[model samples]
Each structure stands twice: as structure tokens, then as C-alpha cells.
Target: VYKGLDIVTAKVTKEEQAQAVHHMIDINDPLKEYTVVDFRNKALSIMDSMIKSKKTPIIVGGTNYYIESLIWQTLVDNPKRAGGDDEDSGLDESLIKVRRIDGSSNEELHKKLMQVDPDMALRVHPNNRRKVIRSLEIFEQHGVTHSEILRQQRLAAGCSLGGPLRYDNSIIFWLTCEKEVLDKRIDARVDSMMDKGLVQELLDFHELYNKDRLKKNEEADYTKGIFQSIGFKEFHNYLILSKEERDDEKGEKLLQQSIEELKRATRKYARRQHKWVRNRLVRRADRQVPPLYSLDSTDVGQWESEVYGKAVDIVSAYLDGRAPSQPALNSVITDTRIADNSTETSQYCEVCQRIFIGAQWNEHLQGAKHMKAVRRRRRQEEANEYREAVEIEGKDERAASVEAEA
Candidate 1:
């Protein structure tokens, strides 16, 4: 974001690398593929060099993989290895690289993984070819499964630059929207993209690499990201199939279609994302991960300050070693139909079937039940704060009185 963009280090080119002080973003080109192992390795190297000058690492990203990897490696592993590794450190690097066995096919991949850890092969999916390959590689090089390797890496040595994560080490802020609203947003975003030269870019790139202009199946990789995205694919199909059609008519038809499908697909995607966050991170106690702090994207509106303030609170709580409070993202945005919402009027959330935002839309969200939910959340936060205050301020009269009453 310094440049008002989310261009990651891996996507930049070498020539662009020389223009600014960049790291981690374009270390490899399209000629060379990238893997999570390489990411872990390169990220650590960049972090190490930064710390030598006593600079702070303020990692900010939406990529769960990058964020989780850095947090896991730094917090759980690498306690004693910070000063540099032993002579045998070369073995660790070799084990992390994605290597292949000779004449490797699906069978060989499974067989090799089974040899080291049959349990792992059973747990991992057969079609997860990348993971299966890495499991075998780790086994061959280190005589251990990847999971166990990480286990030992954690145990080997490391001192905490920070304390245990139980102290507000993180605030997993999940931005969300109701299915209908999210879909409309996606459709609108696609319409905006077309206006911003996406069509022209696609046309230019297509002409530059012409093979078959009429081929619908011959989608370029550049368009793959946009096309696979929620609203763009159908619009792209429309563009390709009707190149000679009027742009205004084509856009209107495609946008309407996108509005429908995006809602269905985005709802599913959001559900999956929520499930993953709950299961993989929030539920993993031993992982030192933090609890999620959810915000309805509509509620946040465009209140960047309020959103950022809540985020800062969550982060500071984690850094200060306390659970986060459920701060509101902001006042929610509502449809004009919800203007006269009231208790007897009956409000409903179509996605979750929860009676909500009250009889009047406003009352539904601030109802006794909703308020109770908020109160319960704040109670937990207060308890955590009280405990931490006693620890830090040392036997405050207020804390002592509360403890005595308890």
C-alpha cells in the first residue's frame, strides 16, 4: 500500500526491482516457479537482514499464507537459530526445497511419503500433488515428515522477542458482507474495472499475442485472475463471444449476469473462508493463534478511521498480551427499504436466517439479544484487561477489590 496498491514482491520484474528499495517481491520470474518453501526461506532471510540494523518488522498483508508462515516460524520456531545456524544448517535448507524423485508419478509420490510417514499420506489428499511432493522430499532429505520437521524446528531453540501469544498477540479481523450486498458490490467492481481499461488491456494483450482471436477457450493467464474472480468471467465470455456488439449493451447484459452468480459464489467462498479461519487458526490452541474479531463489511461502511482504530486496538491488545474486544467496524449501510424498521415489523437476514437489525432494521441489530451478545464479548475483554492490569500495574486497589469480591 505505500503505492496505493497491493502488488506483492513476487510479482514485480527485475528491472522494476532496481527503481526502488524492494524486498521479497520479484525475487523469482515466470521462468522460475515459486513454492511456499521458497517463500519461507526467502522471507526469513529478508527479516534477518532487517533486524541486524535493529529495525522493526511491521508485516501487513491480506495473504493468509504469508502472514501465517511468518508468525509460525518466528513465534514457534527459531529460538536458538537466530544467531545463525550450525555447520549442519545446510541440511535444513536442502530439506525445504521442492525436489522430485526419479520417474516420479502419483504412485511414487504416495509410496515415498508412505515410507517416511504413512500417517501423513493418509491425512493428506491424494490430489494435493504439491503437498504430496513436498512430504516425500522432506522425508528423503531429513528422514522425517514435514510436520515433524516443523515440530523439531520449534523445539530446537528460540527466545521470544515477544511474550506468549496469549497476550493479544494477534487480532484476526474478518471482514464480511451479507450475500446479496456482497454480490452487488462484486458486480459493481467488475463494471468499474471494465471502465478502467480492463477490456482495452485484454484486447491489446490478445492482439500482441495473437493466435486465434475467435477462440473462447484460449484464455490468457493475465485474464485468468480477473476471469476466475467473482464478476469478471461471464463478462469476459460476453466480451469474447460478442466482440462486434455495442459495448453499452454488452456491459449491461454481462453486469446483470455477474450480479446473480457473484452472490451465489461469494456466499460459498465466504462460508469456506470463515470455516477455514475458525478451524485452522482460531481453534488451534497449541498454535498460539488469536481469536477472530469479525466485522460486517456493511457495518464498517467506508469508515477507514474507525476500522483502522479497531484494528489498532486488536493488535495492541495482542502485543500487550490480552484478548481483543469486539469493537464495531462502524455504522452499517442499509437498503432504503429498512428505513422504518420496528420490533413488530419483523426483520430477517436471508443468508443466515437470523432475526436481525430488529423490527425496524436499526432496532434489529441493536436489540436486547444483540446487545447481550456485545455485552458478553465485552465482559470477556474486561476480564482479560483486569487480569493484565493486576500483572502490569501491580496490585491496584481496584483490581484487588474485584479479586477479593470474586
Candidate 2:
């Protein structure tokens, strides 16, 4: 109430969103599906606008990756620009310029990029189509590779504020407590959420937006990107429960148990998130990226307020060009359950790209049709290996001499 502003609104949606606004948070639709990439941009835009309007933007929410991605994507001359001209018209429009190509031809794309901007091609992950296609788009348009533009864009994009500050800092505050304390807190939180109609809200949203939303497994296969988010996944499970198992007394009990499990899972998850921020975000003292400074969240009087204050402080320090504090989220390595990969008799499927655990994946590989693919790839791999060996051993030269003598 610093400026005496009235209610803020967040979109609440099955057709809306999981958010609520004092002003109103449920404006975005559940079916529409939100993303970190968009959230980062939106947060930055809002912050910038608030500053210009002389308003102190008090951004309080359970947000993290958006903030991180905004900082990183901004720091790098991401989506490097390349020289492109219409194959028909050599004139380069620069910004709108693009050379579209097939997504399936990764090797061709790689070759094209190496010929165009070898440096960028090397740095981008081979399988990262987002980065690869972006790099290719630059070459297809400008005709000059982004590795070519980096030194120049640095001069042109100039001392821009927000997103990229020549340098930036990040701090991770872990609201840590003993396992028992955390479990108690989680138990309480879950009870509160239930009281607040978190379950009801789930039911409402499902009835409203499921036409647009999808199951996690299906979305995960496509990498729709929200499969890993906590709230999104919970919302998805609610839908799954409705679909797979009908609503009944037994179902209600199972759902209630699932809710408890989810609350516990989220608490465990928060700890893991803390671990990731601590580990993945750490930096060497002299590295170009800033280091992380972290502390226990429970140590503060209030967890939310303390975390928010430190995040703002971290952002403020970045804006002022001071060295950022190095606080990191520690590692919580989930996914520890690796299926038994050591079953010596089992085979790997190059086609499905999945390892058979205890003959499950092996069954798919050994199936008559799939085995045909395995046989083909194995033969090709062997031939490729043999050809490489022959080239290394000067067998190509020897073979040429034998042919000439014949």
C-alpha cells in the first residue's frame, strides 16, 4: 500500500491459471501453459517499467529459474546473428534474415554451421536444436556467422541495462531445517493448502482447461518443458487421477494420500532445488561468470521475506555494477535410481534410444521388426569402424596400388 494501489489480479484458470492476484493473478489460462522463457522476459519487463514509473517493484513469488535464465540469456550474445540473403536476392535485411532448413538433417546443419560459424558450432551442444537452428538461421540470413558478429554487437548493443549487465551476481538462500522440522513444516503447509481449497482449485482448473493441457509422459516425450515444474506436474497428476481412476471413496482416499505424498515430495523437492542452485551455479573466483553466495533460509526470521530481500539485493548489486555475492543452491541429486545397466546379455536399441532394464527395453530390441534395425545399425557401425581403421592404417593407399597392378 505504498502507493495505495487497489487489488492486483492474477489469473485463476482451468481456463485461467494457478495464480491469484490481490490485484488478480488468474488472467493467464491453464490450457495456454506458461514457461520460464516467457516468465523471465515478463519479469524483466515489469521491473523495468516499474522503475521508469518511479514505482518500487516489489516482486514476491516462488520464482527462480526465470530469474536465472533471464540473467544468463541476457549476458551472452545469445541467438548469434549471421549473414543471410535470399538465395534469389543477395540483399541482407539482417534482423529478419533467415535461411530455413530441415530439422532432421542435423549433420547437414552441423556442416553448414561449421562452414559458416565454426566457433559457435563447437560451443553449442550437438543435440541442442534450439541453439543449432538459431545459429543456422543466422547464416541462412546474414551470410556471416554470429561468431563473426560477437565482437561487433558488443560495440552496438552497447551499455544496455537489464537482462545483461556487463557482469551479474546470483545468491541462493536455502531455507534449510532438520528433516523433522522440515517435515513438520511441510505437513502444516499441506494442511493449510487443503484448507485453502488447493484440491478444489485443481478440480476447477481441470474441468476448465484440460482440453489444452496434456499428460506429463506425453509432454515429456516432446519436451514441452513444463513436465519438470512442481505446480504444473501436480496439476497434471490431478488430471491423471480424474482420468485413470474414477472418483469414489477409494479414489478420494488415494487422492488424499497422493496429496500428502505430493506435499512431502514438494518439500523434498525444494531441498533438491536448493542443492542445485548451490552446486550448478557455483563459479570459480576468476571465471567470467560470477560466484554464488548462499545461507540457510530458516536462519532468517521469515523465509519468504528473507529470500525476497536477498534476491532484490542481489539484483540491486548487479544493477549498481558491484561484485555480486556468491550464494548457490546445493545439490540434491534425485534420479539416483539407475536401472540395472549391467545385465550383460541385454542389448541396447539405437532406434528407441532407451536402455532395456531387465529385458524390457531388450524385448523391444529383440522383437523381429526392431532387430532388423539393430542388425542394420550394427553392421553400419562395424563398417564405419573398419573403414576408419583402414584409413588410419594406410589400407586405402595399399588398395589403390593393388587395383593399379591388376
Candidate 3:
């Protein structure tokens, strides 16, 4: 499970291949969908085979989601099946046909989810259209919010929120470095990628898949497939530039911008990877997830002692059924538990046009927007009551003024 782009596995030397058998590396066509579930199933099969053959299997990768799917049951298997639609298994009608959330703007999708599952909406980044859409789909398909379903799943599994760990005995190693050092390393990696002809690779990829799709007036979504790779989209505009444009001043500026964009994206991705490891995997206190050993990679001078040496020792101790001296990092725990998922009792605010769930409802009550709306409505009610009183009592100017003042 080398969780990386094809370019990464392509760079592997012949000697490396001879050293050990590798699985799930460069196995999927770049144009096709190799989903996390597919990877998890295949990786599990490979691991099982390796175990039976008495060979140790090592799964390495930066794609935390794929690793997460492998280590924990985080995905919803099938909403239809869970909702008792087993009878429609003939032509794959079991799949819920909720309108593609991508059809709407990302903001719209996020806002919609906020209405149904505000807590989930808050947890999921607004820019993450995929997660937002999935949450919305769960709500639309099952008549239950995503948070409610997650709560049910957590309760069933006896885990807080990340779901139950598939392997409680598994040991995870997190290689960490200082932010500035990591950023510089990421910039260097981007430069290396460019030196390796990332531009040419993107051009070839675009010609094969994106060009034809665009010519036929089809969508070339960069959010899916290998296009989601950082370099691919960062260089999208540069790749589209004509050869004539490449020799011009504007082209040079665009090229520089794209290079900087690539570096920034790489650094951002590194931060996201660390955040996932710290927040999702390490913070869960409900059940035994996995023992994560943090290796400080800040100083490359200590690589042998800090990373490789520590990893070898930790693995050896685990194999020997002894506790390793390597201690786990302090838990970076946050409130992952869904405090409330009572969608049935949820109130829909007309002003905000948002659904308020338990604690969120209370918070909404105190929110500035809600308070302002309340004041506005109260003023309107007061005006209406005064008008009614004036009409019924036939009050003169003095009485009306007194009532209004009061």
C-alpha cells in the first residue's frame, strides 16, 4: 500500500523490487477509479496471503484515508441495505439515487448539510465537497442525518467517532518534523518532482484523457482520479499554455506561479497528513485504535537513530510480545463525540433557514444573527399590538403616544 502517485512507484529502482515484494503500487490505471474500499480489500487480501506464507507485510503510504479505511471501518457500506432494501438487488437498484451533490456549488452543499447535520458540517471542511455531499446524501437517502447515523455506528461499535479499529494490535509510526523544516523539505520534493518532468507527465496525461473529454464537451474534473494529485492541478494552467505563450513574459510568470502553487500545495498536504494522524487516529479514546510511535524527523542528522532505528526496535518488540520503550505521544484529543443527533426534535430557523440540533440549537439561540432576527420579530409584534390597540380603543394622539412610549 504505497499511498502515493504513480510517479513515486515509477522512481523505484530494480534493486528495490528485488529486495521485497510490493503490493498495491502502480496497480491501478491512472484514468480509472481506484477507490479506498478497493484498495482496502486488495490490501487485506495481500496481507492475508503474506501472513499465511509466514512473510511479514509492511503497508507504507502517505494517503491517510486509504490507510484509515484499512485500519478502521469508517465507511458506510450501503445505505440502502441498512434501510432494508435488499429486495432490489437485481440491477443494482439498491444504490440510492440521490442527486449528485456536485451538481450544486460546494458552498450550497455545505450549507445544506449544515441545515441537516450542523455538527458534521462543522467537523468537515467546507472545501471538502465530497464529504459534504456524502453527508447530505446520507441525510436525504435515509431520512436521518449523517451525524445520527455516525452516532448509531459509534454506539454499536463502542467507539467514540472514528469507528472500531480493525487491528487493535497494529502499531503505527508517525514521522514528524518541525514546521519550517517540513516546509523546506516539501519545497525540495516539489522541485525534485519538477526536475523529474512533472510538466511533461501532466501534458501526456491531459492529452490521453482530459483533452478528448474537453473536446467532446465533457467535464474533466480534477477532484477525482490521479488528477487529484497535487502537482497535476497545480500545473493545470501551465499545461494549458501554448508553446508560443511559454516563450513569452506572461508564460514565464504563469510558470513561476504554478511552481510556487505546487510547492504550497505540497506543504499544505503535509500539514493535512499530520493533522489527520494527530486528530483522527491518535485522539480517539473510546476504543483501542493503535499504538502510534512518533518519530521526530526534524534533524536529518539523527535519521538512523530517530527513524529507522526506532522503527526497527518497535517492530521487533511487538513481534516479541514485549512492550517497546518507545512511548506514544500525548493524545491530541478533541470533542469528536456527537453530543446530540436528535434530528426529529430539531427546530428549523426561518431567519437562518438552518436546522438546529441539540447543543447547536442552544448556540444558535445565542448567535448574533438569531438574536437580531428575534429583536426584529419582536419589534414587528410590538408595532402590530400597538396598531391593534389603537384601532380597538380608538385612542387619540396623546393615548397613542403614551402607549408607544411605554
Candidate 4:
């Protein structure tokens, strides 16, 4: 929305495009569902072409998971595509009647997954139905449990989890900023987006894509596509307000509220990015994981010394085939990895809608809440079966009476 001023803009100036090539930017319509799987496939294709041409592909973005999937083979396919792309995970795309956990309650879905793959169910949170369903779908399509597949991948990678690295020679640079400075920048950025007509941009997007869905009171899923951007859902209520209401004091209050909410969401998303870098990127059970050099951007005044100059020296050394030196000021996280013993078979409690790992599963099974939920589920099953039986009996009686009359 901020045009050239924005960091993730695809509309690069003619001069910049002349200097360097860019890939995987503005490749999809905002309304359509462009999943991460799609993104990884497309990006890999671009990276391969660039590599074949002897060009170094510089992947720049804040989407840590996307970058992770690109650098590491995290996006594993089902058995059919074990050594292939996920374009054909052996799933039928034509079937509309495919059983999905999307509309089902968390408890019901968890129970279903438990019936098929109890161990997998334990690892997945009940609230995260999308992951649960995807795991179940993989099991159904490939006839192998998701956990088993992950176990195989981990064994191959020499780690407790995660797959092999796509590019071993890759060096990653992580830009770090102090929490106070970062938060303030994010707040200021949100305000700048507002000045750049963020609200109007959201309104335009909603009208173009979401109007039909909203008119029918259908679910506006912010989980998929470009609508997952920070500002879209934050201004949902403000967008839905009528013209009359929007012109009043209530609209002004809601707009201010939405601006604050957008700032808060941006901050939370920034924290999540940092967490992914720390936990997934840096901390790995396998020592072969890629080394990430940290670059401190806490002080903008020292950008030339801390960020740009240091980056230049590291890249130059890397190109010269010398071991890249770590910056003294811009330090790496040296916290040793702690072993998690929870990998032992986990169980899901239907009552608490929670998964208990290791010994906790046994304790949870004997808990009062779980026992009560079990009893309730049994009662519900019995009632449903009885109702079905009654309907069958009524049909039989009607058939007998018709036969007698004939």
C-alpha cells in the first residue's frame, strides 16, 4: 500500500530491476488460496533456475516459515512423493465430498484422529484442527501415519525432528533489534500505513473479495491467502460498519481502536518471527543445521558499521571460500539445546481438549474430567444408535402394512 516505501513491494523501480533480479514476489492474487506448499514449489523452481545460471539467489523476507521450508526440506510430501514435489501428494482434488475436520468441533476431530493415529493426535493441539486434518489426510492418502513419516525424516536428518537441508552451503543473516526500538518502529509503521490509506486499501480488498462471503454471513477465514496480512482482520468491524454509523463518533472510536489493534498484531507477529528464528532456525538437535550469523540493528546510527559494512565483509569472505567471521557485537545465541523427553507416545484427553505427553497421558486418562467426558460421549453414542434403530423399525412396520394392503 505504501508503494516503493514498503519493504515487501513487488513493483520495483526500473533502475533497481536493471541492477538485480527478484523472484517470488507478487505471484498470486490476494483473493485466491495460495498455500505455503505452492509457495515452496514455485520458489524452489526459481532457485534452481538461478543456481543453474550460476547466480546466487538472495532470499530476503520476514516470513521465517517460508524461508525455512525453502532452505530446509521441511515441506515433506506423502509416500507417493517421497522423493518428489508435493504437487501430487496422491490426494484427489476433484472430490468435494471429502471428509474434512474444518467444520467439526475440536473434540470430535481429536477423537477421529485418535482413532486413526493416536500418537500423531497427541502431538497436535485440538484447537489446531487444520494441522490435525492435514495429518489425517496424509494418513488416508498415503496409508502411512504422519508421525511415522516424520520419524523417518528425522532419522535421515540425524535430528529428533526436521528434514534434510536443501542447501548446505547457505549462510543466513538474521537482523536483530532491541525490543523497545522494534516495538516503536512497528507502531510508527502502522501509523504510516494508515497515512498511506491502509483503511481504504482494506476496504477496497474486502469489497473486491469478501463482500459476497460477508453478505451471506459466511466464515471470513483470515488463515488463507493474502488476507492473512496484519491489518485485514484488525479492521474487520470498522469495515462492516454501515455508512451512517461510520460517519458518527462510534466510527471514529472504532478506527482508533483498529489502528491500535493493528499495531499490537504487528508486534505479536514480529515476536513470532523472532521465536521461529531462535527455536527452529538456530536451535537444532543435529549439529549439521545451517549456521546463522546475527546482525544487530538496535542502533540505526551505527547501521554502516553494524549492519551494512559487516554484511559486506561476511559476503566477501564467503565468496572468497574463507570461513566467515562472526561479528563480536552482533552475537549468536549460544544457549545449548535441552532434550525434550515428551517424544514418547502421547495421548489426547477428549474432555480437556488437550494432549498429554509421556507419563502425563496416563495421569490424564485417570483424571475425573476425562472420565466424565468419556461417559458423556458414550451416552451420546448410545442415544444416536437408539434413534437410528427406531427409524429402521418404523420403516419396517410401514413396509409390512403396505404389503398387507396390496
TM-score of every candidate? 0.49, 0.46, 0.70, 0.76
Model 2's TM-score against the true structure: 0.46
Over the stretch 131-239, how does candidate 1's per-residue lDDT look in tens digits?
6776666565555566565445445422112223322333456666676776567556555555565555544433543354335443354332223334444345554
Error of 1 at 113 (Å): 2.8
Superposition error at 20 for model 2 (Å): 16
In TM-score terms, candidate 4 sits at 0.76
Superposition TM-score, candidate 3 onto the true structure: 0.70
The lDDT leader among the candidates is 4
Query: Per-model C-alpha lDDT, please?
Result: 0.51, 0.50, 0.71, 0.72
User: Which candidate has the top score in TM-score?
Assistant: 4
Give the distance in Å from residue 124's predicted Cα in candidate 1 to where it truly belongs. 1.8
Q: What stretches of model 4 exceed 4 Å from their correct place?
A: 1-19, 78-101, 212-218, 327-333, 340-406
Candidate 4, residues 292-354, lDDT tens digits: the string is: 778999999999999899888989998898866764322355777635432765565666777
lDDT at position 140, candidate 3: 68
The CA-based lDDT of model 2 is what?
Answer: 0.50
Compared with the true structure, the alpha-carbon lDDT of candidate 3 equals: 0.71
Q: Which is better, 3 or 4, measured by TM-score?
A: 4
Where does model 3 exceed 4 Å of error? 1-5, 8-15, 79-91, 94-128, 132-148, 214-216, 330-406
Alpha-carbon shift of residue 263 in model 1 (angstroms): 7.9
Give residue 161's lDDT in candidate 3 (0 to 100).
52
**lDDT of model 1, residue 179:** 66
The digit string of per-residue lDDT tens for model 2 on 54-114 reads 7654433345544455444442322331121112343344423443354356667766667
